[model samples]
Target: MQTRNRVAMSRRAFAGSLGALVLCAPAVARAQSSGVVRRNTSGFKLHNWQDHFDELGKGIIISDTNSRVMQQWMPGGEMFIYPTSVPMTDELTRRGYTEITFKDPAPDWTPTPSMRERDPSLPAYMPPGPDNPLGARAMHLSWQYYRIHGTHDTRKIGRRSSSGCIGLYNEHIIEVYDRTPVGTQVKLI
Candidate 1:
């Protein structure tokens, strides 16, 4: 009876350790994949390359795939980072550089002919409202069929879910929309 109890305790201990390792695997893999090592320090910390922060702007959007976040740079180095939805394939968001061409409030959604052809189930047009995928506000990008817009499904804000569009929470969109103007530069890497 003593030997059996010892064996059971050992098994439980091993299982707990295994579970801990499994829970940490994703974070470990993400760090490995990005080649970014985060450390605690008391002094100055060097972030990304200096060139990435060289430019000054009132309207610049930087989308980082590895971190799954978007940083909006306002003039004088005011930066706001928000979680973003990204394309499944990097190719869609990898367009070297682009800019916001226009913006709309409660924008009506119309499926591009190509999108309609690709997804036969998609509606030809969806009026501006709750059912519209482009939630409360939208910023049309120079690239075809892509927009920085509010998403009805806030659950997808930090995930790789959109075809190519950059999605923000509805309230977040309203804040950004009020600040950003047409022709704001957008960089997705």
Candidate 2:
């Protein structure tokens, strides 16, 4: 009789667990469909240079805000892609054509007027160092106060966290800064 009771209890426990799974299946499916579930590193979409550029003039750099990825295409069909941190909001984003006006290997930081307006406590200027927000390198764009630079804060990558600049990892920015020259065509979309 004890053996029969034990078997019955085991079957009851299994049935309860199966029923709970069935009840939760719809919610789990809904969460996945709604994008609550995400995979790391596979979210970026590869883009064709021809689709966005007339030609790779001085090579081209494309920063896609939606995917949080940046692509660099060299003249000889060489291409490199890096995850980036985009502007925090649509209002802060500046899209369309621009070019690299300058490249700074050891960049200083000066908060823009708007940046200062947003945060009054920001310093008037910052010298280059690990603590500087521009990290190890910076590529200035034609647009005022905009840049493609590195961040000491690695958590910012693959997220919408920047004020207006496109941000990369420190090591990645060093590589990009070395490869990209002044006057390289750029587009943020």
Candidate 3:
């Protein structure tokens, strides 16, 4: 009887301690974990594009690098997930928000200065075709040097092998390209 009472008390103590720990965490931690933001303002305030998903509507793309998934929120609240190759390093896929600056069907490929420095063997440029890294479609983002494009290698989809740009399968990118227009916002998280 004494042992049972002690066990009950211990459980209650653990529950109380867990509650306290959660309460003690910073508001930002809570906000990020919940993917919800609360604003308090009497004057003008800077808004984070990530927090206003609904306002952005159909053109919003949320890339979860950890999960290797690109979720597009279409107008009227319809969401679609496209498997993609996310970058391995934060430097490659910097966290931020940007809008699509341009869209190209079968975009030409050119190794960036940084890319060539890393890989000396890469050619200077390759015309849009099956051999091109930027497969069937590409969407350039306002974040300089970053893009969402299709891959010639379909096996790379849903993996972490990209230099920086997010990559989907050729056919999948065709679908995304058909739907996503220029000026669509993309948030890499």
RMSDs, each prediction? 8.5, 9.4, 11.0
Candidate achieving the largest TM-score = 2
**What TM-score, computed on C-alpha atoms, does each candidate reach?**
0.69, 0.78, 0.71
lDDT of 3: 0.76
Report the alpha-carbon TM-score of model 2 versus the true structure.
0.78
Cα misplacement distance, residue 74 of candidate 3 (Å): 1.2
Residue-wise lDDT of candidate 2 within 90-127, one digit each (tens)? Answer: 99999999999999989999999999999999999999
Ranking by TM-score: 2, 3, 1
Cα deviation of 80 in candidate 2 (Å)? Answer: 0.5
Each model's C-alpha lDDT?
Answer: 0.73, 0.88, 0.76
Q: Is candidate 2 or candidate 3 better by TM-score?
A: 2
**Model 3: residues >4 Å from true position, as ranges?**
1-54
- Model 2 misplaced regions, further than 4 Å: 1-41
Q: Once model 1 is optimally superposed onto the true structure by TM-score, how far is the C-alpha of residue 38 displaced, in angstroms?
A: 17
Cα shift from native, residue 70, model 1 (Å) = 0.5
